[model samples]
Target chain A: MEDLTAVAVHTDVSLWGLFWQAGFIVKLVMVGLLGASIWTWGIILDKSLGFGRAKRAFDRFEQVFWSGQSLEELYRNLGDKRTTGMGAIFIAAMREWKKSFEKGARSPIALQMRIDKAMDVALARESDYLAARLTSLATIGSAGPFIGLFGTVIGIMTSFMGIAGSKSTSLAVVAPGIAEALLATAIGLVAAIPAVIAYNKLSSDAGKLTARMEGFADEFSAILSRQIDEKLPRT
Target chain B: MRGSITSSAIIHAALLGWGLLSFSAPTPMDMANSESMPIDIVSDVSQLQKGDKKAEKNEKPAPKPTQKPQTIPDAQNVGDSETDVETKPATETKAKPVEAAEAPKPSETPVAKPDPQPEPKPEVKPEPKPTPVPATEVKPEPEPKQEVKPDPVAEAINDVKPVPAPAETPKAEPAPQAEKPAEEEFKLPEKVAMPQAKPTPPAQTAKTPDRKETPEKPKTQTASTPSKEKDGIADQVADLLNKQKASAGGAKRSTDQASLGASKTTGGSSLSQSEMDALRGIIEGNWNKPVGAEESPDMKIIVRFRLTQDGQIDGSPEVSGTGADAGLLNAVKSSALRAVMRSAPFNLPQDKYDTWSTVELTFYPGAT
Candidate 1:
């Protein structure tokens, strides 16, 4: 009876014990699942913060772009400096307009087309930048559970082998192994659930931001086209 | 991006710290009770000593009283009759000559005479002889009787020479009076003869061909009835001893086996090897591999199921595997399923529900 109690004491079922005593395969599974979970959290954090910053930058750029400031003054304020998201698109439009003026193009239709083309290219680049690393989030979200399940399967297989080797069915003999196995699945879900949720939310947010930028570019081009039409008859 | 990386690192570190803290805390009450091996050994030894002392106290007194009725008559008449005559002047003088002249013939005839007589008569006569011996001397008789009986038997069985010496003494002391029928009333019956026969046969066999002939020669001697009774008693003694030794040896061996089983149980662990063996043994015991199934050592069926705390299956087990003939697979599946069902309500520790609540057993018949 004393020996029995001693055995019970020695076989501590703590989480650390479970991980420490787990077979090599099970330990490997746990480590992989943990890495995946941590990586998923990192992606989630980065995307959420990046999206918030982009929204603020877009708002600030829109205010300045529509502030009734002179076009050359706004262009010079932006200069050739690599600007924020919305500013980049505004700069691209202004550069094309200045080039058209320098070439002595008197046709407003040709001038408007070149300005729109430049802004469209700049808007595409900004959208691409906003959507960066979002695919990895999607991959992590989708693959997280499967990877966790893989770890669980391997851990359970190792546990069963331990049961077979010891020729024991006692819970003490198998509990630690099974607990370790389940931890893998738990970690997998931990990684996957937030990644999946954040992917859905951030991807949609990025889409909305892209549409807003495109809207800003369209309105800016319309404003430029209207000013050109107003001056064309006078010239 | 740098801020997000920093924040994520902080969160990861916090989770890791929480895990470490939980691990570093002392385990719950269930696991804290383990003692060292010396403590266990000390307790076990104390328990064993207590048991041994109790057994000695009980066993020492038991055989003494049971043995007295068997050894008393011969011991008293053969060894104490003369002493009784010398010590007690009144009753001894009155009973002495009659007892002395009567004792030899009766002792001589008891073996041969008793069996032919009704069995009931021999049993009644031995009880009276012990009642007549002075109480003081008879008290010491049992200890010596115990000491003497085994030595002669062990010597007879071992050396083969001491057999004749012991047998000759009894026959020679009563030889002249062996032919007399004057003491028929005082004759010892087959009851006394049967008990005496138990200890003497191994020695009797080594004495003479006459002893062998005595069993066969009893019928011829019966024509001279007195001698016939003598020969028959010798034959019964030899027969009884052989029978007793065979049975005694058998009893000893079975007791040895029982002690072996007790030792196996004594060393049992808390969640004992026997308990685990019982869990698996019950499941494996119920498994019946299908006849004509393809034999593969690696053939396995993995079964997963949840169990309630009391060990009842919470749901049907999920059986998965597909590597054998259809008939074989079905057989293996059903057999494994039956084993799982039959061995349920398992005797497991209720405290450790986290371990057994979900179980996945992989059955590999070839491994067993």
Candidate 2:
């Protein structure tokens, strides 16, 4: 009990005390920044995981797509989720090519033009799908530092004002304030670094996947056109 | 939308984790500040003495000579009644030879006069009849002594002399009158005329002794004031003052001497005021000034600590206005500790055990 009281008494007059008892406003600002940081990191991890899975899925889809399997078979294998995404784009353009050529008015060039337009629209749709929530991730990445900075500014301002009030110049007298300020900055960096890394990774993944989908759409349309030309009279 | 949901969750998680970590770790500054103690007590005693001396000397003019010319026997009475008074005239009438001989009287009265005299030896030169000149001269002698009370040997000498002279003079006067021949006593009714002069000398001496003793009395009154005399309570004050001044001078000299060494130790508590202020500015400037590597001001944190009996800190240190890096702060705390340790068993005057146990230090960076 004596030791505890001694320690408490020691702490009461210390810089640590000043920090613990920092104004309500300062603590609130720090708490708010912390919440923001936690939210940003959660977003970063979620995006990283989701984008990783999508990249893996997209890679697997491409392997099956390159195999000597029928387009209908690939479409059936994709099921619901894949069908509505990048794979759906390939299926849509192929289906369009088959329908256009099956009609009696079948010029290869005319059918190809029709398939190209269909593929362009499908590519647009796939890109739009990938683009969801990217803006929020970007916001988190860019804004993390400033949010942390806001906490730091508040902490520093409070610390210095405390120093002024105490009218002291010793490290012990002033340490808590400085530590709190640095803590805000450190927390800010911690929140921001991963957010930034995660955003960059996701963005690049989206770009790669979008490029591959566009290529697949064009190739699949060509494949469907070849199948239609073969079925028709040799010209 | 699915990716968006996941990404938002990730960002929030990261932000939340950091926030929680920050919240959990409450800085220990308050504890540290409370534990901090005063660093150097010896310096405070020396500093206060300097201030007191400076304040006293700055106000008062330099003390004049404290020894007046000794009183003289009446050559006029000898002339009126003594047959030998005629013999002394030829010596006096030798064209004011006595005044030139008495030219060195002021300097010698203060310096070499060991024996106490009955007659005012310097006053006997009746040729000039300059009684007022001697009186003014004697007052200057006592004034110099009041100034010297801050300096003991000189003050004691002044105190011892004047005190006895005033008391003895009156007793001696009546004896001188009774001892004189009847004819000369008749001619010199002057002794009866100024009967008050004898007792008045002792009274004048007693009043002047207190004036001379004021500087010494204050020292004993306030234990912190410096030296208190054993038998010489008055002398002790002057001795303490001188010792304080000497030690202060010695501290300055030793610090200068220490600065002569290579790689002068910085981050110590003994930095001068301007140096500490300048160091604070440096720390403030360096704080967050660097672009990438999260910079804080390089503070020269001087925690002026008073050491405990067991070598722990006695009291909470006083913190400076500026902030410092973690490494710098630790360095300063340890350096201040080392300084305290180096000055172990501090030479506090035994009487001032409580007061000299603690003092303050303001840290300065690069302040050798």
Candidate 3:
């Protein structure tokens, strides 16, 4: 918000004296635009942190859970805390596989299918989390120029009218006003560009993490399937 | 002896006096000539009738000789008077000749003497009338009457030639003679020459005053001419106003005729043509002609100003309109007031002091 405020002040002033001297109304408009942009930026930061934490946690959980710890021990240590990380997905899949064996419906294919389903659900949930602030960011990205352009259009209209009313032809007469008018658009883009770039990067990163979770689920299924095949009667 | 010489001297003096008196009136000059001719007649008659009739001649010569005896006492009395005393002698001389020639001619002398001699010959008649022999000639007074006009006619012919007639007759005659010269005399050269000299002063004034007064008259005339031109400022301002209006483009919806002065207004206003042109120029120079400004035709700005007594701006402008820019509004309001103040005393119509005292300028960019 502060940076946005600074940008606003800098842009408004450096643009033209008129923008600098803009009235309370214009200041309100600028403040509103900046406020919106700052809000969107905050959402972006929050979503980025949340998504990064989830991806990092997923990776850490994958590494530790697959480090050859005993399955029963891993389950015992998952105590009370919602172990709804990638590690939790592995536990859920294993529990489902054992229940299916006890039900006499156990097969390598059925067990792998249960693990993939649980992993798919986990990946879908993580993907939803990762994509949280993106919609707002997309909105900010697409709508910013239009908002800025609205202010610019207003400012230009006002400047031209002033010229006509004053009957002035000097560039000095028109430039400041026009510059003030365009400031809103510039600020809009300032908010929008970063949002667009961050959103794209976060979305692509979320896709990669989802793909890794799927691959992990596939490998976990394969190991479980081999273990189940070794224990089965040579049928 | 003294009496005879006196008689002879009186006879010569009388002849000369009658000659002068005869010519005094026109009638008497012929009468005197007749007397002289009669004297010549007697001498001829003395030679003819006397030589032929000796008794008649003796009688004529006897009366002539006795005429002298009777004329002798009268001649003494004639010599006492001066101007006419000399005419008495001529009567005596004519009387003597009358008796010397023939009795008939001698008898006719007294008749001619009464008519002619009363005016001219009377100066000589007193001398001759005293004789008893001429008393009978005086009784035949009809002959004097018959000889009156001839005497004057003959004397007039002899004494004054007709050459002097035209000159003195026209002078003496009252008909046209005196009248002609009076008119000529009325046209006195001096009276005419006096007015001719009098015209010079006015002519001199006409030339000299026009030149000398030119500089002076223009000073007074120009002082008034400018104000009058100032009053006419609006008409002069019309063209510049149009330029200002056009520069406003569609910004101004409409224009109105703002009369500078309504009552007793001058032809010129505070905004002279030149000043308005200057203002228009300023506006044109500054304005870019707003595009789509006319989209809203109802938009307008009415700025009102209050000027101090000294023509300085007294208050902030009150503005009302959609398109009014606060800065522009402020500047224009202030500038208008400053212009009014700078123009000091606002060259407004003096008579409309109340109306223009605090002006409200209505500028509508989108009037129409």
- lDDT values of the candidates? 0.61, 0.51, 0.50
Please write out the lDDT profile of model 1 over residues B171-211, one tens digit for every residue. Answer: 54432232221123233222224334233322232222222
lDDT of 3 by residue, B179-245 (tens): 2322443332223233342322222111121222223333444544654565465345443332221
Please provide, for model 1 over A60-142, each residue's C-alpha lDDT reduced to its tens digit, 9 standing for 90 to 100. Answer: 87788677778899889888677867888988888898888777777889889989999999999999988888888888788
CA lDDT for candidate 3: 0.50
Q: Arrange candidates by lDDT, descending.
A: 1, 2, 3
Give the per-residue Cα lDDT of candidate 3 at A58: 80
Q: B155 in model 1: Cα distance from truth in Å?
A: 73
Which whole-number lDDT from 0 to 100 does residue B244 have in model 1?
26
- Against the hidden reference, what TM-scores do the models get? 0.43, 0.41, 0.34
Clashing pairs in 1: A4-B270, B111-B233, B112-B229, B112-B233, B113-B229, B197-B237
TM-score of chain B of each: 0.26, 0.18, 0.18
**How far does residue B292 in candidate 3 sit from its true spot (Å)?**
53
Computed on C-alpha atoms, the DockQ of candidate 1 is 0.23
Give the number of the best model, judged by TM-score: 1
Q: What does candidate 2's lDDT look like per residue over B1-368, in tens digits?
A: 44644566665566555754565445544554342222212223322221222223322122222333333433443432222232345443442333333434434543433332212232233311422233333433444444454455554465355535445565664534422322242333333335445433433343343343233333324332322223254344334432221112222322111112122222223435554344334333333322311233334444454645443456555554255656655555565545544444443333332333455554444332
* Tens digits of per-residue lDDT for model 2, A83-194: 6446777777766755765566457777777878888888888777676666665776677677767767777787777779889877776666666666566656766676
**DockQ per model, Cα:** 0.23, 0.10, 0.00
Compare the candidates by DockQ and give the number of the best one: 1
